[model samples]
Target chain A: MTTFAPGRKASSSRRHPRRGEELTFWIFLAPFFVGLLIFTLLPIAWSAVLSLFDAQATVYPTIFVGLRNYIDIVTDPDFLNSIGTFLVFTVFIVPVTLVCSLGLALLVNRLPHGAGFFRTVIFLPTACSYVVASLIWKLGLFNGLESSLANQVLALFGQQPIYSWLNQFPLFWILLVTVRLWLQIGFYMLLFSAALQRVPEQLYEAASIDGVRSSWRMFWSITWPQLRSTTSAVILLLMIAAFQAFDEFYNLVGAGPTARPPLVYLYNRAFTQQDFGHGSAGALVLTLIMVVVALLQNRFFGFGAADDDSPRKRASRKKVAA
Target chain B: MPGIGSTQISRRQMAGILGLGAVTPLVLAACSGPGASTGGGGSHPTLSQWYHQYGEAGTEQAAKKYAASYKDATVNVNWVAGDYASKLNTRLLAGSGVDVFENNAINIADARAGKYADMTSIIEPIKDQFSETALYNVQIDGKYWGIPMIIDPQAFYYNKAMFSDAGLEVPTTMEAFYECVAKLSSGGKKGIFLSNTDGGAGFSSTMAWATGTDIIASDNKTNGFSGDVDALAETYSWFRKIQQNGFGLQGQPSDWWDITPFANRKIGIQWGGMWSMPQAVKALGDDVGMFPMPPSGSNGTYALIGSNWNQQVAQKSPNRKAALEFAKWLWVDQKQDQEDWALSYGFHIPPLKAVAASASKLQSGAAKEFVDAFTKYGKATGPYYTNEIGQAMEDAGTNIIVKGADAKTQLAAAAKKIDASLATLQ
Candidate 1:
């Protein structure tokens, strides 16, 4: 074993000079820092300031009403309804997406041939623009006319024609969930497939040698435990994506009252009603909810935790040796 | 390794390249401004005229042609494609290069906030030549803020062959209208097509007028539908029946704005605007006939008459005078252009009374019937009927008609919301 004298090595390297290394470090970081300041930080600060004012008529706020906008948004029935609608959408879509994507990934991973073609075909819908996909679903497939594809298939089965899938209650939810599933399933499936590929062949072989004859037992013992990190990441991403759903809902249902999500509600308040202050407050509240949820998820999953054999743990172990 | 002098020279060149890269975007951004010129090359003050994209063919070319013909100023017509209202509002707030633009309804708050210029001086001289309803919403605080461009009167257009086959005459009462719908809906054909997306929002104005209720009070502060809740509820129940009985086309390929369903014989009757006359004529020939929404209560038959487009000069425009003069020259002084704009491309009634009367298109067939119906029963909305109030009513209508909510409860809720909005206006 080689001994690591990390303190002496650090002291020697700090005492020495490298030509142009410091300049290169800053040169690479400058662009990213500039962009962060300009695009992300500035807008966040400005929106925070705007949330404290009353800007109903003009672009700039003329009256300062501290926390009143926030109070109003929390009390507003339409805003609350939008939140309820989004939560319902999330509860339905997140688990369905997880199960469907995982199933697809497992099926594809088990295939020995034509796997690439299957993956590509399944992934094709992800490449389509949300607006174009929504229009195709609305005008071509679910159009309530007797000649639409859905109705035509139903007609063959002797089923009566049902009109206005978007206006109907549970069917509207199904429509939204189906379109979103078609768009997002391929990406999550690819993630799970990559994670599945990383599991060692020896783990499955060892479990089988120990009399684990069933595939279910092998998966539970050898496959699932190995995919903990990826599963956590996938669930977190799906939750966040479910919260920020705007394009599909906007293009499908439009600004109708029945299916208004929070983002659409905020958009109408800001652009349609010209109430920027309340809209900004609503955005801030949504951001806070997202951050809290992310924090709770991180707390439960312990994402980015250093493994015993990781480089970070190794470096700390060497420091302890010093 | 390179020599010191050569290395220094290379470093200087590198610095110069990076500097250029950093400054290029700034220079380009400075060169590019909002509402940058798309067409006009003249030295005259180019007055930018913005218009929402008209679906009718040749409307854009006609607008540009009219602009090019104006000798007083170089007019650059900007045909905004999608979400014209939102874009226009944003630009107005930015106080950009919009010298003039078109909107169907002028928001009084925007006008009061000084976003639009007063066109009273130009409109007052020939105001009498325009119909009273044409100038109704344009005048704010007894001053005209916009020039009326064209009038689109919406009425019922029925398939003549289908009506005759059903052995039905034109409906003169609400009960008879339902009976006619049921008769026409036989054999897989929908009886009527209102709007696919928002249920019956397109026909709510006409329905209210037919029921002898002004949705908005003349005082512009109180709700008018509250006075006759039973009658209004009855009308909404009719809409619900149309949907529940499948008498109305629910999800067609196109919205009610297009005459495709009517033209394709998928729907027997359509509550469509006069703008679809050309398309209907092209598809159905003489099989189309038009009539106003018949009397529901003691009210007489009525058609919804509203401005198709109104031209208004921006308040912050540098060339306000030039813009106003061009608007007057196009919409008011040049009577032939008004007639051409109304009849040539899409068949709208000219806002100017004489121009509409003189147009040969308005003299015969279904077009003549539409004109007659409009003349006898065109009911205009109040000046205070803003988009917010309109949206509230539309939501209530959707609730009552599509969702089968309690009509009285929804209307009461809508009235409360509308009163709150009006209070803000006050």
Candidate 2:
């Protein structure tokens, strides 16, 4: 009988990976590390270098102008408008998406059968590309009062079609918000659904026997407290996504006259207008703002957090389960 | 569904994983060398040529035929359909753009950066073969940047049926044109379908052509566009008058109106371009006819004729000989292509005088009349027409038409910018 002791030569031999194992680990990690450096770190470094120059299109030679590009970006009215648009988008979309997703998860959880099928149906929109969705919304679903499906239904009731819904102010924001909600609610619902399943079934049964008959009472006492971590994570993810609303606006309204998100505007300044320096400066400012928002959300909400788990919390959870 | 025996990913781990997966390859590719457009049979020294979506299948066929005729050379033509400038600029910046490509005057300033080759010798010999106005567009700062391939003059098109219904003859003068507008609008029909958004700038182009305006008089460094301002104000006054008279800014606006409304018989006359006629022929089905805008005061100033795409070689091209060879062949050797492009979709007037007279089929009688009018009475813009000053004036003029911004205010602002831009040019 071979007993493997902790420090025994045979046990140590079994514990340490062979040279082949070490090589295999690096081989597996090589692809991912290379990708990170190329796509994220390198472009970031290049952009930082570009931000100081006056990089016009192939015409004017690019010259390093120190913080002039940054000054221009901060002072530009167009930049301010983009920030305002992003704030409005974030303020409305984050809470709305969260509540709707939570509500949907609870609804589907109560369903007696075919929960998996319903979950798939709800989550389907998230899988579709933003460009595809925006196109459908632009040409087919919200084209105009006369041609759109929504307007056609509205017309049946003798009401004017909501033509130019995206053209008008505030309404355009609401429309964008609605489209985003349609896309993301399903994914978050699935997340909360899984979290709800993890919540011990016995506690809910006890609460029921104790005459906690009201749905709100049950949710407040049981579901809400349990979903705190998940809700925090989902909200934080949503806030980050909202800041990067370029694909939707870029496809729909284009960078023509009206629809100019910060990223789109940055792209236009850098590429279209051939002002690479300005474009780089704009990109950095936008990056800083987004990173700050993400950090703040992470700190306050404890979303995407590794420190969420602790011995005390684990003990309490086990006791609650028991 | 997410937590069902699934592992939780740490943020740092996720970042490291994604960074390795996504960023590394792209950075490496950028750092290496220019990515070529096509890899094919190496029987010939293949050069990549970029074109726009404007020309249809006939243009492509013509280009291919030209490439096939070349000995020890093959040209691979890439057609860009949308977001062209952005893509081209990206390739240019990355040091990986095509050998020869077509771009418009609007983007010429950028194309002339240290990236494009000076084609003074190649273009100088062929310059006299082109309309003086067409030749002017290819030159930037006393150097030939490109070879002009086609001339597209913005013109006016009217439905023959709509005109007959209104019992109106085609207007012969600017005054007569406005009178026709009044007659057309009285019977619940729009006089024009102009979108203020695009029309403001578009209208300014032809207006400058008609007014004989020397938009900018540049003597090396000192820039002048005071004359352009006077002409712009006069042109905006005309458009404002038309709008205020209950034309009702309705339907798809701007120059795109040459077909949409005219096809539906919703409007009698549309201010558009020679390129617009073919689409009109398709939509209205053989009843379409066009004429140059009536003279402002009968001094022979009519429509502003200009070229759309010009071909230039990259100065930084390691294969300079290959790039210029490809460019010269694209514009000159492809004479059949030049003719076919000139004739395609009724949109082009060939830069080659021979193609216009021989190969192009301008069947409409009104078109023939305008052809004669150009031969006898047309006035091409001067060399100053293609300068930084001209562009600034155009920008100023466009703002007035679109925004109804005070022409004097906008024009003056345009002058200052023009002056600043000119100072840098020298």
Candidate 3:
């Protein structure tokens, strides 16, 4: 019998390990790839194809009208108006969410006690479905009935009842903004809190020793700068979410000329009007807008860059330079 | 010294968790797909019937009971809830499962696209049983595509107690109606509640009819409201004036479909349907009365009448013959079930004249008055009155009545849009 060394088996296994490892890696990745291909990639491809046809109520399009659908949507007054409405909504909602969520995160982060309790309390609304939250806001609070909570509060201040806040333009923005802030601010606050924790304590101590007595100054110098990446992410997400606003508008404001958003307009065009070609074209146009905005934001903020260069890394680099 | 934290999970474990997370939904979907079919595994052919979820109790159970009684094929009743029209349209396009369905109005475009089957042979014998107007809606190119289910007559329901207490006679003219509204707006009660916010949505058709003008012309090609645009504008101006003067409720807690405002004495009058008669009777007992839209200029008062539901067979159903047999048997042959469907849960006029004549609820006081109004002043919605056209009219009316936009301009713009949409249908 030939003598066998104990380490030879290990060496032989290492030499041929990559094939099995590769197979296992693919096995783990297959489900996700398959799902993404079937649900996301296929629908996107089909929508792009659909945008070129004059498909009405039917599944198959007999007439291929190239660029006409796009031209019609661009010139369509209603589609343009819907885009304007969404922009107005985003302009107001995004900054308000950023400020409010940051303020909340700062306040919660500074608490010596009951921080967890307050964080959970603030984050509770995020768990609620948008539809349910919208209905509660619409029917329970701003129902336009004299007996509603909002009107009751108004009555306490010796003001007359204001019915149907949704019907009132510009004033209804307050309602939409309030509900969105209530639902979304919590998650963003958590994100800010996590980023705040990763901020080095030594920097704050050093700043305090350098005679920086004001908390505002310290925050502006340290905390805000430390949260640059998180803030950029929050803003990008908020803009995308604001652009895709449909549920709250659909549930609260309903279909009317008053507050028709782009998605709702697209829905009416596709399903209600049975003009699939126009709907698909509108969707592609919306997607293009979102992509352009995201690219612009990335260009300004450099979000795609790896944010691994900490103070230590910079100091080591400075030492090398010296 | 520790290298990595002991609490950290291994890469293999992480991969396993992520893989499970992604695979779970797909596996669940695969497992649940076949179980979703309501048809049991048997030799008998199973037919799927769809109905929009009705608000009234016992409607679903009644549908199930009716389906259970059909022995020719196993009938699976699918009570669809929320956005039924869109869902039905999608399923019909997919061309699967749906053997029969209930539609409020048949789309002529869908009919031309071969979405619905021709039911003329089944209805030709009993076609005389249904009213002429009911038959008129389903007839496309001299062929019936659907069978009428129920007739819902919409009119204004007034509180008799409030009217009598105010010593107000039922107003028969537009001017008299305005005076009645003004008189009723006292003692913490408003004169009328048209709808929650649209300020009388469906009533525009009634108003046009009352003005002796058709909203959609007989030819279904041109705008009918254009015939007497000035008169229609004047009528809308009167609505705006009433709204401005606070004679009508500006914003109520309930919508136009709800009879609660009139029942609870919150408003003197409300635009409601015959479907809510049971709720009105339960709340106001003998204190309720019905009236049509008061005559505007020289036309007689008009009651808005439309089909509540119509049974249709999907043209793509594999078992179309069996499905048709089930539909005719249930909707046509069984008159008792039809009456039950109309009168038992919530009040609706049976489409069959013979069944309607024998309905006990239709022979009495308030119900009888409603029936009489429906018979005398009833105006059926034209076959060409589609959801798109309805939406245009609503928008124009809202602009005129609520926002006080120029009525002639708004109506003209609306007519233009309607003509364009109707052209597409042609």
Candidate 4:
């Protein structure tokens, strides 16, 4: 009845466009939000709530025990022992892994030919699944003290090979550290290699012209300055990874008296003993330790030459000065 | 040139190429889930089974046979290759574990907290089929919490070649056992292969049973031997004697220690369970032979027998009755199938007396010697020691024998710890 102009129709089409945009926005975001809510967010929320109560393996009604789990775990000798074991593991693994991977990177960096092949070879262990590597170590190769490859190597000498390398203290510790070092070297090596490549050729050439013949001087003056961020990153990553060494110990060392990592100890408490509250408390403590360690490592060991203050740190100061 | 390029890039062409790459990753991840295999997951009822895949033929055959028989219900058997208890507990707590499984009694009793169905009524009708010990081992608090699927009775496997070479008879008395062990050792073959791993539960269980003082408490309602420290001390002293003699395997990783010396023909006497027999046969073939472990005093040969394989319906299972009915069919109706499965490998002993009788003839010669060890001298006890008491026995058994830990002090401490643990169970 009313004369509807063509321009009016076009203008009307633009009406309620905000609603259409909102619909499209939600449509695009729906899948991710649903998955996040279902998988990550819900479980995290449940774990936090459950951490406050006495939850057994079965879905029996939980009792609000009021921080009793945290207290018990702190006091328990077994949990304390596990903490000691984790400390030992970190002390042994962190420095060893960092040094070995760096050394391996440097070693391969000098290779004139087949550098890619050597890199691939070093990285091969990383590509093999942890579960598979653990099984291979447990069976076929290790076998027993008398027959294990290590024992056989010992047998070549005049020593009578002991039956159980895993039972003895320092030997067991060494074996575990070695296996871990083997598995982690490739991962850290790849990181160092990438960082080493990014290091400008000009820095090394400048150092070389200054008659810095020592490899040590070159590393400190040239290589290290460039790798500051990367090294800090690698250290933080390796520390976290070392603390999370569960699968290898779980599969290889087993739940025997000799070998139980902190994660394994926590797991045994939660599932084996059905003491979930205590287990969650242990996990929380572990998380706190990890966070603190990471922050400290970054703050102190972060890339630097002590000679001059970085402009970045000074800029924050300059803002306050202004 | 621009016109031609625009014409070539048709709407459908652009959409098709873009869509293919985007969808490929999603498709790949979907295919990576358990259901990707033709064997796993569907609308069909999946009967989840937990099994240890230590040996090749023993485990794989069982899986194939179970899958073949149960066409209507899909048998989803997850064979764990690591520490059986740890993995089983993880899956159970995750609330997505096997519907039916097997483990040692101590592990099962602990698992009864929430993971299993109250199978007291289910096992009532079929109670007479098993021996009293078998029945008792599976019962927790008057309820049949687990079905005794396989009886793992520890025994002494002797390499007939080595025994004959040493010209020693299977020992009957403690003194005689020592003499034979010494002779076997002097002949260059190791005297005994004693696995002291898993807190040496295997060796300690056999020794505790032989001494007539239960290594673990026999009742879940109370502590070890009702606070009988004297009895616990006596048993500890006896183990110390065994440890001092040539009868100890140094504490090592269990599986490797159990198999290596026995397989290499370096040991004449290997103490292990029925599960080890098939492995021995596979490694040494017909050359291997087995007998009941030597008796400790007049207590006679104390063979440690416990339920290895058992299944329970999930209380939360939607098809609870159907799931239980499947278990019954697998265990009771197919008792012969179980016997045949065991006989095929030449080691496993069936729980059913009828099946045992039928298989007895097939298991003659050295096999008879091993079966006799279980049949004649075997004794099973329920509510076996858990936690501290169990740890105490292991400490006394291995530490005293191998590491020279004082028998008296360690044993006394063990008894006290066990008494405390039992109090909680009560």
Best by TM-score: 1
Q: In model 4, which runs have C-alpha deviations exceeding 4 angstroms?
A: A1-36, A59-61, A111-114, A145-148, A198-213, A302-322, B1-115, B164-183, B186-189, B196-202, B218-264, B276-303, B362-366, B369-372, B375-377, B381-425
Alpha-carbon runs more than 4 Å astray in model 2:
A1-18, A58-62, A160-166, A170-175, A206-210, A307-322, B1-44, B55-57, B105-112, B163-261, B264-272, B285-307, B363-426
Cα miss at A16, model 1 (Å)?
A: 11
- List, for all models, the DockQ compared with the true complex: 0.36, 0.10, 0.20, 0.15
Clashes of each: 0, 23, 1, 2
lDDT of 1 at A3: 94
Candidate 3 lDDT over A228-292, as tens digits, reads 88998999999899889988888776666567799988988888767788889999999999989
Pairs of residues clashing in candidate 3: A144-A164
Estimate every model's Cα lDDT from 0 to 1: 0.81, 0.67, 0.81, 0.64
Q: What is the TM-score of chain B in candidate 1?
A: 0.92
Q: Mind giving the per-residue lDDT tens digits that candidate 1 earns over A30-70?
A: 77898899889987887888899977757567789999999
Worst 10 residues of 4 chain A by lDDT: A302-311
Candidate 3 docking quality: incorrect, acceptable, medium or high: incorrect
Q: What is the TM-score of chain A in candidate 3?
A: 0.89
Query: Which DockQ value does candidate 1 get?
Result: 0.36
Better of 2 and 3 by TM-score: 3
- In model 4, what lDDT does residue A91 have? 89
Q: What TM-score does chain B of candidate 2 reach?
A: 0.79
Estimate candidate 1's alpha-carbon lDDT, on a 0 to 1 scale: 0.81
